[model samples]
Target: MALHWKLVIDTSDAPTLADFWAAALGYEVEDQSTLIDRLLAAGQLDDSVVTEHRGRRTFRGFAAIRHPDDPFDRDTGVGQGRRVLFQDVPEPKTVKNRLHIDVHAGAEGLAALVERLESLGATRIREFDKGPAGHWWVMRDPEGNEFCAAQ
Candidate 1:
């Protein structure tokens, strides 16, 4: 069996990053508020670690988005696979990303998708048309993380 994993990204503001990615990928932001509420009620967790986000309680230091079709814990809303976790970091992104997400927007949708992303705060970096490799546009998320929108 293949090992399961979720890509984790560091961000200065986890919720904002999570929101952007959720819209970008048509994913759902995981909701762990029920668990948080249970833990808080049982005195197993402190309010210090939680914060209000989008009108719900969420972990202050992290947030996540997952493919809507993927399996997830019903009670906690934690994805079982195919997810991206965003964790808070004190330092900002200072260099190019060594690993980046490449969004596959079919040839017909590439332009529109790129424009939608730009409207969501992604900045266009450049575009390339590799004769055999295909066409793509480089972009940076609101927080400066680089990714590609490709055909």
Candidate 2:
């Protein structure tokens, strides 16, 4: 069988990137605090590794989200379906992403989505063209990771 997995994006700020991708793809942010809670109870993660947000204890560096109704274990809240995991990195991003996501818009629409992404701080870098496959626009995230949105 083919291997199935989620693409983990390593970044300096997980929550910020997660929010950007959530709004960019219309995906909901996943809360995996039950796992965090368990770790905390077990003394695995020290208090310094966690932060308080809205009166809730949130781990500082990890956040995730998935499409609504995607399979996720209720006990731990890790996604078992379509997912993107954003994890924290200490150093700044110094180069482009070796692997990037290509968004398929497929002639349905582009202007609105691109405008929204720009408002969310994504930069529209360039447009790509193909004879039969058509076109897409390449963009860089705030951290300089490149992704393309095309139809």
Best by TM-score: 1
Off by over 4 Å in 2: 42-44, 53-56, 106-108
Question: How large an RMSD does model 1 have?
Answer: 1.0
What is candidate 2's lDDT per residue for 1-151, written digit by digit as tens?
Answer: 8566888999888888888898888787877678779999999889888875445566788778797877888877777888998888888888878999876663447776677778988999998779577877899877778998876
Write down the RMSD of candidate 2 (Cα, Å).
2.2
The positional error of residue 131 in candidate 2, measured at the CA in angstroms, is 4.8
What is the Cα-based lDDT of residue 146 in candidate 1? 100
Which pairs, if any, clash in model 1? none
RMSD of each: 1.0, 2.2
Q: Estimate each model's TM-score.
A: 0.97, 0.85
Shift in Å, residue 56, candidate 2: 4.1
Sequence-dependent TM-score of model 2:
0.85
Model 2 clashing residue pairs (backbone): 30-65, 106-151
Error at 29, model 2, angstroms: 1.2
